[model samples]
Target: MAGPLASLKVLDFSTLLPGPYATMLLADMGAEVLRVEAPDRMDLTRVMPPHDGGVSTAHGYLNRGKSAISLNLKDEGSADRIKALVAEFDVVVEQFRPGVMDRLGIGYEALKAVNPGLIYCSITGYGQTGPYKNRAGHDINYLSLAGVSSHCGRADSGPPPMGIQIADVAGGSHHAVMGILAAVIHRQQSGEGQYVDVSMTDAAFALNAMSGAACLAGGQEQKPESSLLNGGSFYDYYQTSDGRWLSVGSLEPQFSSRLCDTLGLEKMKSFALSQNPEHQVALKKALKDAIATRTLAEWQAVFSETDACVEPVLTIAEAAEHPQLKARDMVILVDRGDGSQQRQIGFPIKFEKTSCRAEWIGKNLGADNKKYF
Candidate 1:
């Protein structure tokens, strides 16, 4: 069966993580995506480390299922070629800073002229109309400016750098996909397309969610380790005897009781429920001491049958081999454009009727140029 987004065609002029990742999700869902890149100025992902079959693994993963066409936007005829393509492709995704696309002559307004119903999405650090719109920024900067780092890590050492690009993927890529799809639905209803201006900083600011709600409405400024879920209580990670970590999130009364019982710290159950800082500190220390007495495997065995929300923190390799991830088919194989296939992460969303699959890994620059140009 065709995927739900099989009917849509996208012309992607984005490079790097944010926009490419967004379009990648679209392509994975069966949208016909044509990625346009510059021949002279190659995307860094194409040459990023960890090559498989002589191709950058990052590029292969991000651009899977999408066709590629190389064109130098600086050329005088490039705008005309894009305009012609825009007539057929109903959606456009770009990631250039503010005014860059306009100077290239293929901004939203120009493309919308070619296809009035085009869903044009631009992902940026700030927005097209913000005071800092033209300023250059990355994921870390966006998170810092948006106050995400304020309440994220240990107050003593400051916010630790994240393992993943939270602002890029969650803020920019995910939000852009959501905005584009919303615009698609709006266009379906009103027969009019609109430009989607996604600001990573803005999205990251909104990601404060519960903390932001308290700050805005209740005037409670959130700090690191200052809230229940943020290590203010016993609901946090504890190191085992072997130095492996176990995340404990037994926040509810019943679960906390079970956790305390399983750890042989039943006397600390009332402290787990108490909001007093001293009680929380004592309960946390007791839990930590108990967890440290056993290796991760030993603790895993002890908690395996218990109803408490406790689980070992697995490495990426361990996670890939985990039963739940394996059962969910999170790891998949994509064609490498040769006879063989390469392992990659699969689309996460499950559909009842429709299906989603990658046609192939990312292709060489201009691999589909003759077909489109």
Candidate 2:
């Protein structure tokens, strides 16, 4: 079966999580994505901790379903060689700061001269023309600036989720992929390609569209924990019996009632007043007391029959081995050439006739140099 993006060709010059993940998604959808890495200084995640027998750790996971080509951009000869190859690709993605690519003579202007239909993408902490473009920032900074980190965590922690690189992976990669596809469509029509500058900060702002809307309607910035979506007594994570944690999302009255019925809180309906914090406290305490009486499995079984909107918080390992995941084939182990077969998250979107597959196998550094160059 032909993949949805089978005809696309992407040149991924960006490194680390954001760029690799974006290009990897394209590759998974059967695009010929070639990752350009430096011979000397590759992505930091390549050498970062949790090494499996001292091989590229996080890089292997992120770069799955993509080809790798080693090029020393600092070396004029190698850079020129890379520039020549860039003309053949449909899309080019780079995560460097504003002027780095232009300085290297491989920016959109340089590449578009050779291939007029090239879709060039630049992913950065800040946008190309922003005042903060020159400043160095990471995922945390982007989330912080975009108002994402403000309402992320529990009120007591006063900190966001320790994991989940919201800005880099979600905002950066997702935006880059969308922009690249959009540019491809536009280029097909106009036969002219333009530079796509995707700032992580701007992308991060997209995550809070609903919150922004609520703020606009109220004519005031919604306070943390006050919004219905944020941490309230109803839609929050709670500890279950046997010390396990589960998230409950019974925002609607029907769902909440169903959940209460499952937990045998149908009789404790007097404490349903969650409009005020003090009332929410009484409700939370009562719900907690009921949920603590039984194990997570018990609650799961009870909610399985209704639209309670509850889920046990599974760790990454547990999620990988989950029955639903296995039934849906949501995780698969791909051959990494080494002894180990790397586990990868499966393709998210499923189309009926246009089959989108995770095509390429895991590759090491400079794996596709011969094929790409």
Candidate 3:
């Protein structure tokens, strides 16, 4: 079956993670995405380490199912070409700083003149109109400015650099996709297009959902290790005897009781239920000591059928090999256009009638230029 977005066409002028990742998701859902890259400039993802089959895995994964066309926006007549393409494309995703695209002559107003129903999305670190709008920043800077790094890590260690690009992916990419789709829906109703300005910092600030609510409405500023779930209570990771770790989140009374019973510490159930700091500390110490006594495999066996929300931590490779993820088809193989297939992460969302699939890995720059130009 054709994917849900089979009718959509996107012109992607973004590089790196945020905008590229957003367009990747759209392409996976069957959107016809044509990437406009520059022949003179190089996107870092194309040469990022860990090459597979002579291509960067990051580029292959991010640009899968998308065609490519090399176009230097600075060149004469480039803006006119893009304007002509925008007349046929449904959306345009870009990651340039404020006023950059305007200087290049293909900004939202210029493109909108060509196609009144164009969905133009701009993803940036700070946003289009702010004090730091033109400031140079990255994922870490955005997270820090958004106050996400303040209460994220251990109190003594400060905020640890995240393994994933939270600000880029969760903040900019996901939100841009949502904004574009919402604008698409609006255009369907009103027959008008709109400009979408996505700021990674703003989205990260919004991600502080529970903590932000507590501070804003309840007059409670959340700090690292000060909240019930953030290492203040027993709901945390426990190191096992085998050097592995297990996560325990038995937050409710019944689950706490079951967890205590499993640990043979039934007397600590009341402490687990208490909101008192001293009681929480005691319960956490008891859980730590008890969990330290068993290997991860041993604890896994004990908690395998238990009702408490306890599970072992697995490495990335282990996670990919996990039965549940395998059953869910989280990993898949995509064609490399040379008879071989490359294993890549699969599209997550499932549908009853429609399907989402990666047609092929990313192609070289200007691989489809002749077809379009």
Candidate 4:
């Protein structure tokens, strides 16, 4: 059976996490995604460590279910080939500096000429037009510039690096996918396509809604660990006696009361979500002291029957085998074509009639050149 996006065709000229991830999602939903890479300028992710079947694990995961064709965009022949492909592909996603695609002779305007209904998406560090448009940056730089890091760290600790690439995935990849899908719907109605200019910094800044609201609407600058969602309240993480951690999110009055009751801290009920620093400190200390008396597993068992949002922090391996994730089939086995199978995180989008699939892992570079070119 065909998936939801089976009719769509995408030419993915982006590399690394953001664009690749978006295209991967599309491919999972049955889009015909053709990954275009330079013959001599392969994506850096191809060389990243933790290789499986001589392919980078990250690449295998991101480019799964997609075909690949190598083309040197710097060459005139490649330019002509891309123009021919532009007319066939419904969507074109690229990640380059502002003028790089234009200089390559495959900008949105040029491609739109070939295929007027082409959904062209550009993902960059900054936008196509800005003082920092041409600046080079990664996920961390974008998050910092967007003021997201200002409210992410502990009160006394300097801004620590995030465990994941929040800006790259959320700001660039997810936003680009949203824009492309919206444009797809608009094209269906108006028979016209538009350019989606996605800036990582812009997307990251937009995701700072909580802090932005405080600053813009309330004229308040949020400090790290001083906001309601940050660590100003009883909602935080606590270390257990077994040296593992558990997240606590008993924010609502009912949940807070339940947590206090479970921990035998009835006196701390009034300070559940208090903004006073003294109250916050006292409540946090009391909760931490109570939590430290038990192991992570013991606390998990204790909270298993409750509505309080408390859960043990699991590592990546543990999460893969978690009951909830396992029941949902979030981890799937892929054939490496060498008499061996590899486990990978499965597609997330679930549909009743047209479920997504992971048909295969990423192919070798230019593996589909003969078929496409």
Q: Which candidate is the best by lDDT?
A: 3
Give candidate 2 misplaced runs (Cα > 4 Å).
Answer: 267-276, 338-340, 359-361
Q: Which window of 10 residues has the lowest lDDT sum in candidate 1?
A: 152-161
| Tens-digit lDDT string for candidate 3 (1-373) | 8899999999999999999999999999989999999999999999998999999999999999999999999999999999988899999999999999999999999999999999999999999996899999999999998888988888899988999999999999999999999999999999999999999999999999999999999999888898987777888999999999999999988898999999999998899888899998888898889999989999999999998999999998888898999999999999999999999998989977889999999999899999998
Global lDDT of model 4: 0.91
Candidate 1 residues lying further than 4 Å off, grouped into runs, are none
Q: Candidate 1 lDDT, tens digit per residue, 27-66?
A: 9998999999999999999999999999999999999999
Best by TM-score: 1
C-alpha lDDT (0 to 100) for residue 301 of candidate 2: 79
The TM-score-based order of candidates, best leading, equals 1, 3, 4, 2
List of clashing residue pairs for candidate 1: none
Candidate 3, overall lDDT? 0.94
Q: Rate the local accuracy (lDDT) of all candidates.
A: 0.93, 0.79, 0.94, 0.91
Flag the better candidate by TM-score, 2 or 4. 4
